[model samples]
Target: MVTIQGIAFIPQNISKGGEKLYILNKQDVPIVDGLINLNSDSSQANLSEAQQQLDLLWNKLDLIEMNDELKAISPAMAQGKIDKRLIIVHRYIRLNYGEPLTLQLLADLINCNPVYLSNTYTKLFKITPMKYLQVTRMKKASELLKETNMSIKDITTHLGYVNNSQFSTIFKRYFSCTPVEYRRNQHLQMRSIGIF
Candidate 1:
């Protein structure tokens, strides 16, 4: 059984080399950004139902055989395949920046080993995945500080920080100012410009 974001599936027939199955979730499906440990019996039952539907669909579709030319392509030529997964990871980080995220959890979400994912992501984006995640969080926090009246503690908790001090520390490290100082500076700048 393989699960992505709490949705589980049982592969009826998996090839020795593994088959790529692209899943497009519905628009309304709640996106889970955190780690989901599926150990309950209900989760198992849901997986079984989903697998039955997938198998039925597979049996109904006509399978196509790849040509020898396509089959002859080396694994090195297939490097482009990782590009989409990397983009997905980036989008997930942007959407779920408030969620608890770690290298292993992100790799598990994408079905890749953490080391490989880290190396490939860093190579392609010129930034480590965790670094990117931190940047995303900080950016969102900055926006919240500039635009909202939420307290620093509230903002910190909203961004999934364990405490105000840690949030303030990271915010200062990233923006060269603490949250309160940043907000005060923003307001002062706006007032100086006669916009407040």
Candidate 2:
């Protein structure tokens, strides 16, 4: 299968100028190779159809780029390109905090060396990526504890902890209270506010 996804962004300047315009296109098509004999008439027909679709997509992209609304945004996008590697790492951590994560795994995700990723991430965020993962996991665990009826053991397991004791130790070190205490305190605070 082949999928083409497009997103359009209006620069800050354009927004300040009081114009809102965007064009987004998303489509998916199944592509099968070796489905018919190479010289067969059916194969030739399918190839022609695919080529027409691709040409249409390119025409649309060209039109969008030539549009005045997109012209105002293109230069800004070109001038202020964000670091894709950093975004990828941050998103991976946020989405996968419940899974076991390691420095090497994060580096692999961004196709960079572990040492380089660690150094770059530390410089950009003032904390190592692994530490960020740990903090993220702790934050999520804290939220789950306060909001759900899940037990300590379940929360620990959900956050990728090997055991409840280890989870409690780390949770205490990070939040200055064990998970149980934190949950109890949250409940008491909620009650005081007439929420519980």
Candidate 3:
């Protein structure tokens, strides 16, 4: 007789994947037990229950099928499909510029291979994720420089830079001036234009 072993309840963790559930037996670990993802609209309390529900659901989904109208829009549908995932990853990186956002973390969040994600992201956006992150940090640094009187060390720490020297080098490379010079120039330019 089949016995219920163990259970694993993985919530709707987007960083792990889409909405998915994994169940294992006493001997089977969560990672090894395999998973049954609730793709459409159905519930899987258990494996046999999941199989039964999915089989019925598949038939229903197949009956509706894709028509000529849907076929014509397949590319659009596919583009939209990937675009949402891409936007989510991009926005997360933009919003978490001060965090240690490693490539592995981003890959897990977006549910793709790190190398593939890196290559595809670079191809689609014309920049690597690290490069994008660096630019994002620089943007934040620029905003702080223009708006606040924070010290160089403070800006460096706020931007998650390892040290002031690294921050200053990148800041200079991007703005053609050191942080101090950049901040000074920004203030003088704003005052000259009555922007302050």
Candidate 1: RMSD to truth: 17.2
lDDT of 2 by residue, 1-196 (tens): 1123443433222454243344332322122222222213346576566546545555554354345433444454577643458657966887888888888898898888999888877765556888878877886887788768999988988898889998999999988898988999999986675444
Candidates 2 and 3 compared: the better one by lDDT is: 2
Candidate 1 per-residue C-alpha lDDT over 1-196 given as tens digits, one digit per residue, 9 for 90 to 100 = 3344345433343474233443434431332211111212236665465445444434322121122213433243476554567767867876788888899999998999999889988876667999888876886798788767999988988887889998999989988888898999998985675434
RMSD of 3: 21.0
Q: What lDDT score is found at residue 128 in candidate 2?
A: 88
Judging by TM-score, tell me the better candidate of 1 and 2: 1
Query: How many angstroms is residue 33 displaced in model 2 relative to the true structure, after the best TM-score fit?
Result: 60
State the lDDT at 46 in candidate 2: 62
Worst 10 residues of 1 by lDDT: 32-41
lDDT of 3 by residue, 1-196 (tens): 1122232222223454222233233454532323234322234445455456545543433232213224534565587744456556767887899987899999999788999888877755557888889987987898789868899999899898889999999988888899999999999986775434
- lDDT top scorer: 2
| TM-score of candidate 1 relative to the true fold | 0.58
Whole-model lDDT values for every prediction: 0.65, 0.67, 0.66
Error of 1 at 7 (Å): 40
